[model samples]
Target: MQSEDNLLKVLIAEPSAIIRNGLSVTLKRIPGSWIQPVEISSIENLEHVLETNKPDVLIINPNFWGYVDMTTVRAWSAASKLKIIALVSSLSSDVILKKYDESISIYDSPEDIKEKIFRLFDTSDTEKDKSSEESETLSSREKEIVVLVVKGLTNKEIAQKLFLSTHTIITHRRNIARKLEIHSTAGLTVYAIVNKLVGLDEIKDNFTL
Candidate 1:
């Protein structure tokens, strides 16, 4: 059980106003608590609300995941204390929100939803800053590759420049993704700039995603 002083804050997101209103009422009534339920009928304001209100849990429509960039989601997931619970409609939805804190079926009964929210308090682990775990300390060669990639070198081009095989360059790309947990060129551009692998002015126009 959470501390008595802690508010039972939940942000219920659903497309249907009727369904969202119903869910807010049902969730607010889960016993022995100071109920604080906020309904989000659209994802456009989600980023702002999440940053400002800082709710304890975020119960979102699974489709909401598709509306934003994974980079945005990754940044939010990295910083937010709120436990994310995706309302899954199918097995595929699970894949969409796989990195979320928890997932509950849309078809679950109110009681089940209550239980799952309560359980989040128990099962939720304190997430350290993922940069520590996700962004591995690159080897000197890896750093070279990052700099080269940021300089707009294709895998074949980089391999030839470095006197390595194309296959080696491809493996390095995969390893870089595994370490950074980011794959898009845009995301990588930001990473490279922030990490000082390359200065912002050094980035070529063609390097954009």
Candidate 2:
């Protein structure tokens, strides 16, 4: 956890120009506290944000997941220890809320977001706090396979998309089952939601998924 005296640099990866600016203004309510909001419109700018403007926290909308690859996000979070705050209108996955570094509902006013941010100052030190949603076991390929499987892809479709043999997909599926102890598509979908691998919309629109 960061000390209360240190400035909390928040990077807003929200898509709407309006919300980004609004969050910038809203997150700076504390008197004498230096809470800076560095705004970016898309995931493409994440590398620049990390290299040039390393933020202490990443505040993003649920829609951000739609545009960004979840595998990259998970890897970065594990390696960077960058606190991820997913601000959503509604939360379907308690695991995501429980496992993610932080999850705040949009219905909660800006004051609520501010309160959560302040509370997070005590969340971790050298390591990020763990939640039921987190796992250090899966390789990046396994994560990809999980996402495709949750999207209701057949083993053949997943193989085609990933450019692997169908047999390879089958092996990976077995490995996933062995590692997570989950065999059903519904169970895997819940795992993905808890792990923040995919959003509800992705499941609803499998073609785009």
Candidate 3:
């Protein structure tokens, strides 16, 4: 059994009570009591709840971004290593979807939801070991690409700087994403900062979703 301090705090922000409660119930049935979910039905209270709860993971609807931008939401939980997962119910543009660390469809099965959430945490010993191994396999070029990416450089910009073709830069980025298992620019930024590949000050003002 996991200790209390090791529990994963999850905040579910959805307007519908049924969806919020359903997600909470699904999370609870994951065998271990390591996940502790807190649900809120209003987007207006999101910032306050985020500040107070400091949850490890946030499962929120993308529509809330219309009221609160991704950068602002990230700022409120800057103290914690927060992972924002979009609780998508309707069609969202690719640009909007890429801002989040992950996405879960409303129609996803309970089992699928559990898997997606668990993979983010990677709590199992075997999974942790595999992740560690994969993390170590990043090439120096890939590391450079990751740094440029976190610095808000477009693929074309990075290609120009590195004297490489745009196609090559895109390929490198794809490989980097696969290696790190992080799909979004926001996620890549966090990884770069955490891994000391880029300093926070370098990207604080310039970083985008």
Candidate 4:
């Protein structure tokens, strides 16, 4: 159960007014939960709201019909001190999977919204156990990649940060998938969070994700 004092403040950054409104209503219905949903049509508006509100979590639509860059998301993550939950229509492609990093959580279906929300806000041993399993399965390179990925880096960004080619980064990502037996970025994001390879506080400095 959520504590009375610690309300789960949330920001919904979606371009579609209908989706935003529907999600907001659902979030508000979660018993003992407090949510603040903001509809943002542009990346600039999203940034502005985050700066002003300092939300605890951000639920974003990656296909918000705008030119969103890695820096934009990273900056939002860094400034708002909020965990990002990315909403996508599907979790099947490599390009979207590549966007999976520690700082962000990915949800494929609208049905998954509440589950993901509760997981983020709830502090439980069940979540801890799940995280432990994920940590135990990671290789050294994949672990390194997780840290960088959480920092909102693209494949090229991660490769450049690690002083390797983009191709090498892709190879590492492939190996990560093979070792974990997971194919989607959403899976990787969950793994990262559960294991603490990517953390909420780690983004305080200019360190890797």
Best by TM-score: 3
134 in model 1: Cα distance from truth in Å?
24
User: Cα RMSD (Å) per model?
Assistant: 15.7, 14.6, 13.8, 14.8
In model 1, the Cα lDDT at residue 42 comes to: 65
Off by over 4 Å in 4: 1-5, 77-80, 90-111, 121-209
C-alpha lDDT of residue 138 in model 3 = 59
Question: Can you list the residue pairs that collide in candidate 1?
Answer: none
| Steric clash count of candidate 2 | 2
* Segments in model 1 whose C-alpha atoms lie over 4 Å from true places: 1-5, 69-71, 74-79, 89-91, 123-209
Q: For residues 81-200, could you state the per-residue lDDT of candidate 4 as single tens digits?
A: 456666543233446534532222231123335545655545445576674344335445668887776566799999888788777677667656755777765566667777788775
Q: Is candidate 1 or candidate 3 better by lDDT?
A: 3
Q: For model 2, how does the per-residue alpha-carbon lDDT over 91-197 read when each residue is reduced to its tens digit?
A: 33444443445665443455546656665665346434442223325656778999999888899999999888787677667656755889888888888988899
Report clash pairs, candidate 3.
none
Q: Which stretches of candidate 2 lie over 4 Å from their true place?
A: 1-5, 65-71, 74-79, 90-92, 95-99, 123-209
Computed on alpha carbons, the lDDT of every model, listed in order, comes to 0.67, 0.68, 0.76, 0.61
Best model per lDDT:
3
State TM-scores per candidate. Answer: 0.50, 0.50, 0.55, 0.49
Global lDDT for candidate 3?
0.76
